[model samples]
Target: MTMANASNPFRGIRIGSASGAGLAGWQAETGRSPAVVHKHPVTYRCPLGHETTPVFADLAEEEIPEYWDCPRCGRAGSRRPGTQPGAVGPELYKSHLDYAKERRSPAEAEQVLAWALGQLRRSRGEEPAG
Candidate 1:
């Protein structure tokens, strides 16, 4: 084995076509053609005035997305200039307990807490209070 093969066992193995002409020859022999795709460009502007236009493969007009992410600042960009993402500010943070309270009433929360305490007591081999 050569010094190169000693370092990498796969050094002797060859992968795909080394030349573009080989690929062209294979395509000619197979009689298969590449698929044709239609693409269009869509433009969006972020509130920070960053403009981004990306090519999209959309055969129909309805396939285009309403919003695209701004590549520059990573903000949500709007397809229309007037409907920028910053029109609505970021939502206020809500804790896990706040979300839980929204989903459950006070009585329901009390019942759940009591059940949880009962389960904990049972695991500890103690009788749960009524």
Candidate 2:
């Protein structure tokens, strides 16, 4: 049945109610609303080795489940290990690090490492060395 202005507390959002004269009838007649709906954002990877796209809030519920093949890899669905069908966060970060490593010269690596260490210290609320 179609819910009326359902509020999702976890996501801190509200789903608008479906319109129409027989909104209640439509809810009772069909198990779901004719209007498109969406739930939690589903994480998925684009085939092109690009960063994983965050949950697409604007996509319709039905279309959300449909696989949009990656433009680069031409693979359907986000790459996840084993039966777990979702984007792997660590893999994404590692891939970025690898890309940086490939692009960095020896001196650049040292500079980047120093910058990263400074960032880490700042994140931990520690003062960076001058």
Candidate 3:
């Protein structure tokens, strides 16, 4: 049935009226909404040029993180360079070889590779490649 045709049981009821007094008592006591808390916006930029600004609580600057995950590109982002104190430049990527070189000399690496290759060749019953 259409609402216009349906008869409301309390059609004439008003706020604070005897019929709606219970509803009125429980209704929001104030017409205005609660006050909004303070917020701080921080922008982060990824290497791919994606930028995202997220809101944080208006608190100490140190409380904010230095890096955040980019919502658009799924990469780690840092604050814009030279914008804030203690900002750091993007770290240079290091490969496994780079780290291994740091720990061992070229001669040692060659020796290890030769030993490993020898073991593999022996397991396969084949001569080791020079």
Work out the TM-score per prediction: 0.46, 0.24, 0.44
RMSD of 3: 11.2
Looking at candidate 1, what is the lDDT of residue 28? 53
lDDT of 3 by residue, 38-68 (tens): 9999999876788899999897988998877
Best by TM-score: 1
Model number with the top lDDT: 1
Residue 117 error for model 2, in Å? 1.3
Could you tally the backbone clashes for each prediction?
Answer: 0, 3, 0
lDDT of 1 by residue, 28-69 (tens): 567565555678889998878999999988657777777787
Cα deviation of 56 in candidate 1 (Å)? Answer: 0.8
Candidate 2's residue-wise lDDT over 1-130, tens digit each?
A: 4455457634322333544553444464565755664545565655444434545657656665544444455455453422223463223223566788789898999998899999999999999988
Q: Which segments of candidate 1 are over 4 A away from where they belong?
A: 1-23, 85-130
Worst lDDT run of 10 residues, candidate 1, spans: 12-21
Error of 2 at 98 (Å): 4.2
Evaluate model 1: give its TM-score: 0.46
lDDT of each: 0.73, 0.56, 0.69
